[model samples]
Target: MSKALGYKSFGGSDVQEFFSRPDLTPSPVEVLVQVAAAGVNPADHKLRSGEAPDLNGHLPFPQVLGLEAAGTVLAVGAEVTGLAVGDRVTGFALTGAGTYAETTLLLGAATARIPDALPETWAATIPVAGTTALDVLDQLDLPAGSSVLVNGIGGGVGIAVAQIARDRGLVVTGTAGTAKRDLVTSTGASFVDYTGGDVVERLRALAPEGFDAAVDTVGGPSLHEIAGLAKVLVSVGDQSVTELGGATVERRVDRSGLERVAELMVTGRLDPHITATYPLAQADEALALVESKHATGKVVIDLRL
Candidate 1:
């Protein structure tokens, strides 16, 4: 049997529970991974709370809860190639098998081999936050020296976007809560505290001519307020950004994107910034930290812990 964390029904953090299940079996194009670490993301809670419908529409009840993981491949389906048992890798759980468990299934096309030198904890964060950051920036395709504003730049994807933007030579200014001030500034982004008085006034004072592009990680009224601050805008947090003339991120959760992120990490161009790791037993605490919106960097669940 394999141990896993999940929810019996959609609700809140209080709905989460632990249970045991039979070992997972990979499909013809999937890989069976022995998960060493699972990246905790806002999407996890969003899916658990019934805010996002199950994309597959076939996930069983008492749904498992995670999207990305890094570990050793224990087995591969008959149709799988270029991977083998015992390969260290990172991948998205596109099959809806979920990663917050001792074992899970990863789609073969979305999984990529990790460099031997990269730690599994960091590799675990690549599928969602890393790829999302790359995808949004690539979609914007902003030139060097252009000014960009990252609305709500405190979370995992936002932080990755800030760092990647800096590397591309774009001038980055970010809006974040006061709790994340130091963390945001450390990425070389000029930080604006969103909780302070008059956010637009503060932004005008920072970028007199307005930004060339904007990527939002926080939605609702704040997104509405900042939508006009840039010529181009995209939101990863909410699809409602479209009503305001902006669009949601163009996600690319493929092996190439995963490989690119792994290369970046191997070359010191990216950091997952995993601030805290929880054992599978304490998965609730880890999820709570992310759900609270105060988590500075990435959070991961270590299955071996």
Candidate 2:
């Protein structure tokens, strides 16, 4: 049996429970993995709380709660040719059969073998936060020396974006809580403390001519406040961006993209930061930190711990 952390019904943390179940079977385009580590995100709690019905509406009850993981492949489906048993890889976990467990299913096309130098904990973050950063930047396609504003630039995806923007030679500026001032500025990006006085005036003073583009991780009012600061706008998750003549980030999940991101990490061009980790027994704690939206960097569950 595989031990897992999951929710029996859509609600609050009270719905989460630990249970044992049969090992998940891979589909024709899937791979079975013995999870060594899993990445935590705000989406996990959102899905568990029934906030994302569009994505979780079809899922069954007692669904496992994780989107990305890294581990050794235990088995591969008949149609899965790129991976073999015992391969160390990372990718998106199959819906319902999540990575927050002893065993879970990863889609073959989205999975990529990790380099020997990359730790499983870091690789586990590539499938989601890492790639999301890449996609948002690629969608914007800003040229070097161009200025860009990263609204809400303290979370996992936000930090990744700032680092990559710096590498690409784009001028980066971001707004975040005072506690994250060091973390945001460490990437060579200018940091704007959202809690200190008027944010709009502060941003205007930094880039009076306005930014070439703005990539928003915080939606709703935060996004609205910064939308006009840049000529181009792109949001990571907010579809409402389209109404403002901006496009939401387009995510492309494939083996090649995963390999490219893994290479960046191997070469030290990208770092997940991964400020916190927890054991499977403390899965809820790991997720709670991420859900709080105040985590400095990535939060991961280390099964090996």
Candidate 3:
């Protein structure tokens, strides 16, 4: 029996149990993949904590929690075309049906062909983060070369957003921990440390006029100050970026930006940035690391191990 990390109870518990189950038959419109790496998202924790909406029905006993993975096509159903066996693939946004497993199934929903130049880890990286970043940038309506402030630069989405915005020729400034400050700077953007308090005061000191756009990956009351300083504000988490009052605000969700992300990954500029890896069996540790909020970049569960 193939093993998967599943949620046995709600309320902030990330514990998953291995259980035997019948194999899933891939439908004609679906493809079966042997998961290579799974992306750990903040939503995974929110759902477990009973904060986000429980998708569809109540949790099935031993519920699986991940929403995205990059893997190879192991089997294909009749209704599927263009994708076939031996094809290396990455999953799309939401439509989450237990991707944190040795084997997972995906519909044609938002699956994209990964570029040859990009590694599987990178191919897996952009689907969700890239889309969210670009979407928020679009909402900002900022002209090219405008200044941008990216808070929470250490996480997967923040890093991806910074790179994408920089590619658009915008001046990007990011706030992150000292360890991640360099990574954000290496992407050809300015790095600032807000790991301390009074981020607004420091940002004001750096750019007294404020930025054209502000993307807050870590949402909280800090948005109030970010909104005050920026023309538009974007939040990628489930929480509100709306504290900005009259300023533009956006909350990231599934099915909103993956297609654009797919194109960028396939033909445009996106590179691999897998900072750390963990085996599927050690997913608990992976979640714990992310929960610590000290991870400088994407923490992927390497299912291949």
Per TM-score, the best of the predicted structures is 2
Instruction: Show where candidate 3 strays beyond 4 Å.
Output: 54-59, 77-81, 93-96, 246-268
Per-candidate TM-scores read: 0.97, 0.98, 0.87
lDDT (tens digit, per residue) of candidate 3 on 1-305 = 66887666666653556554557678777788887888877767766665665562464666676777788888888877677798787875233356678887877545655655656666566556666677777777677889989878778888888877877888988888878867887888787777677877888988999888788888776555577777766777624555454333353443336556766665756544677788988887777777778877787888878
Q: Give the best candidate by lDDT.
A: 2
Error of 3 at 239 (Å): 4.2
Where is the poorest 10-residue window by lDDT in model 2? 93-102
* Per-residue lDDT value at 288 in model 1: 95
> Considering TM-score, which of the candidate structures 1 and 3 is the better prediction for this target?
1
What is candidate 3's local distance difference test score?
A: 0.71
Residue 146, candidate 3: alpha-carbon lDDT: 96
Any idea what lDDT model 2 has? 0.91
In candidate 1, stretches whose alpha carbon ends up further than 4 angstroms from where it belongs are 54-58
The positional error of residue 78 in candidate 2, measured at the CA in angstroms, is 0.9
